[model samples]
Structure formats: C-alpha cells, structure tokens
Target chain A: MQVFASLLAGLVFGLGLIVSGMANPAKVLGFLDLAGAWDPSLAFVMGGAIAVGAIAFFIARNRLVSLLGTPMQLPTSRAIDRRLVGGSLLFGIGWGIAGFCPGPGLVALGMGEVKALVFVVAMLAGMGLWVLFEARAGVSK
Target chain B: MTIAWSTFTPWSALAGGVLIGIAAGMFVLFNGRIAGISGILGGLLKPAKGDAAWRIAFIGGLLIAPLVYALMATLPMPQIDAGYGALILAGLLVGIGTSYGSGCTSGHGVCGLSRLSPRSLVATAMFMAAGFVTVFVIRHLINA
Candidate 1:
C-alpha cells in the first residue's frame, strides 16, 4: 500500500510538472532571465504551489496519525543558524542557474532530457558527499 | 476575461508544490519519515538495521514516475549546456552541502518549514543563496 501511494503521488507530481511547463528547462531558464525577457511563469508556479500546500496542511494538521500506520516524524528543531542559511543559498543558486531543483530534477528524468540527467548525476554526487562527511565527523546514524 | 490564479483549476506547478507538501506530510504521518531525497539516498549507503527496503522503494518510485507519465502526457526533454565534468562537480558540491546542512530542500524547506522550523528557514535561504551565486558566477563571471 505504501509503495502504491508513493508511486501514485510521484506520478501526480510528474504530471503536474508537465502541465505547469516546469518540464521544459527552456521555460525555467527564461523565467530566470530577468535582464533579457523575464518570464513570470515560475511565479505562477510558485503561487500555485503555495496555495495547494496551505489548504493541504490545514486539513492534515487535524489528523493525528498518517495512513501509513506510523506517527508523523515532525521536526522539533527551530534553530536559525549558519548551516540553514548556507544550504538555502546553495539550493536557490542551483535552482536559478540550473532551472531544476531536486524534485523537478528527478521528475525531469522521465523526459529523457540530457540536462536533467546531468543534474541528477550531480545531485547523486551531492548526496554521496554528505555521507562521506557525516562518517568522518562521527555523526551517529 | 482574466483568469483567476487563486483556485488553480488546471493546477499549476504551485498545485504540484502543494501536492508535494501534502504528500510529504502524509508520508510522515504514516511512514514516520521526511520526504527528503538526500536522507533517503543516504540511508541506502549504510543500509542500517532494517532500513534498506523503504529507501530503495522510495527512489524506485521516483524513477518510475516519469516512465508512467510518458504514457499519458507529452514529456519534454531537457537540454544540458555544461559538459559531464561540470555536472559531476556540481553534484559533488550539492552532496557535500546537504551533508553539512543535515538535510535536503524537501526535508528542510517543504517539511521543516511547514512545521515552522527556523532551521529550515535558514537552510532554505542558504540553498537559494548558493544557487543564485553559482548562477551569477557561471553566467557572468566565469561566462560558462
């Protein structure tokens, strides 16, 4: 059941990307080109995302447990530190330039786009680097 | 007639983002895990006590989603300007960054922020900053 839902959700996500024009790197790049002819589509995308999330969160907040048969693992930490600022900078810059963030990058793979492949490859490497650093620092898994 | 952007009838990327948030929330609700790619992928590296199957399943689901979509929609192909070497470097940088920060955008930005986590706020900011700087460097400074 978990597997089914996850896949179904992913499909819905991919479909959304396709419908929203996010599947096209050119569209994303165009939006980033403020100096040239800036496209406001990304903003619409952002707006659409925020709207859906707001309602969904409100509804889910009342639910005590998830359908997956386990308690939701909500983050308890609220620290505002260097690590947080640094990570957001990195993510945003990457998104602005590459025109694909982690989620869209993964979904872009289905498009068989070479650029998406490059991004995913790099994304995987980024994941590997974290593991290496964590091991060296003796961060308990 | 102006189209109302609020309702999102056809459901834009914003709709997708909302679904992603909802999915992340529900994922935690039932599975007790954050919908973070790095964490899930990281778990695959160590394969700790009874924690390999779900991680694999999660990634597998991500991979399969596109193939399924191809059947129903007209999927667009991505064109990569940079070479393979540049891409490898970028990937490594992101991996290192995620590790240092403790999680990816999805975990921190989507899930964490939804829960009003200050750490996520900072992380999201950093991720954005890094992306912006990298682009500025590549496009303006380095001329890549």
Candidate 2:
C-alpha cells in the first residue's frame, strides 16, 4: 500500500513537472536568467507548490503516524552550518550552469534524452564519491 | 533585466505546481516520506533492507509518466545550451552538493520551506543567491 501510494505520487509529480514546463532546461534557464530574458513563470510554480504543501505539512505536524501507519521520518536538523551553505552554493552553481535539477534531469532522461543520460551517470558517480568519503570519515548516519 | 512576458505561461505553471504539491502532500501523508527526487534516487545507491521496493516503484512511475503524456501531445524536448563538459561538471556538482546539503529544490525549496524550517530557509536563500551569481558570471562576465 505504501509502495502504491509512492508510485502514484511519483506519477503525479512527473506529470506536474512536464505540465509546468520545468522539464525543459531552457525554461529553467530562463527562470534563472534574471539579468537577461527573465521568465517569472517558475516563480508561480514555486508559489503554487508551496501554498498547497504548507497546508499538507500543517496537517502532517498534527499527526503522529502517517496514513500507512509508518512513523514520519521528517528531517529534524536545525543548524545552519558551513556544509549547508557551501553545498547549496555548489548545487546552485550547477543548477545555473545546466538548468537541470535532479527531478527535471530524471524526467528528461526518462524521455530518452542522451545528454540527460550523461548527466545522470555523472551525478551517480558524484554521489558514489560522497559515499566513499563518508565511509573513510567514519560518519555514522 | 528584460522580463519575458511573451513566453510566460503563468496559468499552466501554477496548475502544474498544484499538481506537484498534491503529489508531495500525499507522499508525506501516506508514505511518511519527502517527495525529493535526489534523496529518493540517492538512497538507491546504498539500499537498505526492505527499502528498495518503493523507491524503485516511485522512479518507475516517474519514468513512465512522460511516456503516458506523449500519447496525448508532443512532449517538450529539453533544450540545454550547455556543452557536454559543462553538463557533466554541473551534474557532478549537483550530486555532491545535494548529498552534502541533505536536500535539493524539491526537498529544501518546496517541502522544507513549507514546514517553516529555519535551516531550510537559509539553505534556500544560499542556493538562490548562488544561482543568481553563477548565472550572472556565466552570462555577463565570462560570456560563456
């Protein structure tokens, strides 16, 4: 049941990505290009998403367990440290450069975009590197 | 700063965003998970016991949705202006960065902000600022 719900949610999310024009790198780049031909459409997308999400989160906060009876695994970290800022900066730079975040990147790859494949492969490699470093550092998660 | 009003589709964007929000909302409500693509995909790298099924199912849904959309209308072909080298580098940075930051646009920008998380707020601001600066440098200064 949990798996089915997740699948349904993913389907809806992917449809939203496509319908919102976020799956297009050009559209994403247009949004980020504030100094050039700025597209404010993405802002609306964010606004709409947050509006609904806020309400849902409020409801979730009142609940002890999820609908499927699983314990909520919401993030509890509150510290704003160097890792957060630095990692975000790096991610932002990458986003600005390629105009492809993880969701849209995967959506593109699912559509059989060759460049998307390359990006996904490279991304996996990068993630692998993180795991390697984490092991060496003995970071117990 | 020229606003591209001609190309903007506010209505569809908002509608689509609502759909995304619903999906995310349902995801957390039902599955007890954040609808973050990077976190979802990243977990598969080192899968825990009994954890791989839903992740794969979710990703399969993502992969299949576009194909379903193609049946009704022509799907938009992604137009990436960056070269392969830039794309690869960008992908690597995003992967490493998201892992370190513990979230991405979906996780931090949408879900975290919705929950009024202070750390997420800071992370969101930093990423947005960084994105703006990176674009500025690339488009104007570096001329790349």
- Model 2 C-alpha lDDT per residue in residues B7-108, reported as the tens digit of each score: 899999999899889988998999888888888988998889999999998888787778988998888777878889999999999899998888889999
lDDT of 1 by residue, A8-85 (tens): 555554555566666665666555554444455665654554455445555556666667675555555566666556
Per DockQ, the best of the predicted structures is 2
- Give me the runs in candidate 2 sitting further than 4 Å from their true place: none
True contacts kept of each: 0.42, 0.81
lDDT of 1 by residue, B8-118 (tens): 234455665555655565566556566776666666766778667666666666666667767776555655555666655655556556655667656676666665566
Q: Please list all clashing residue pairs in model 2, or write none if there are none.
A: none
lDDT top scorer: 2
Candidate 2 CAPRI level: high
Q: Rate the local accuracy (lDDT) of all candidates.
A: 0.61, 0.88
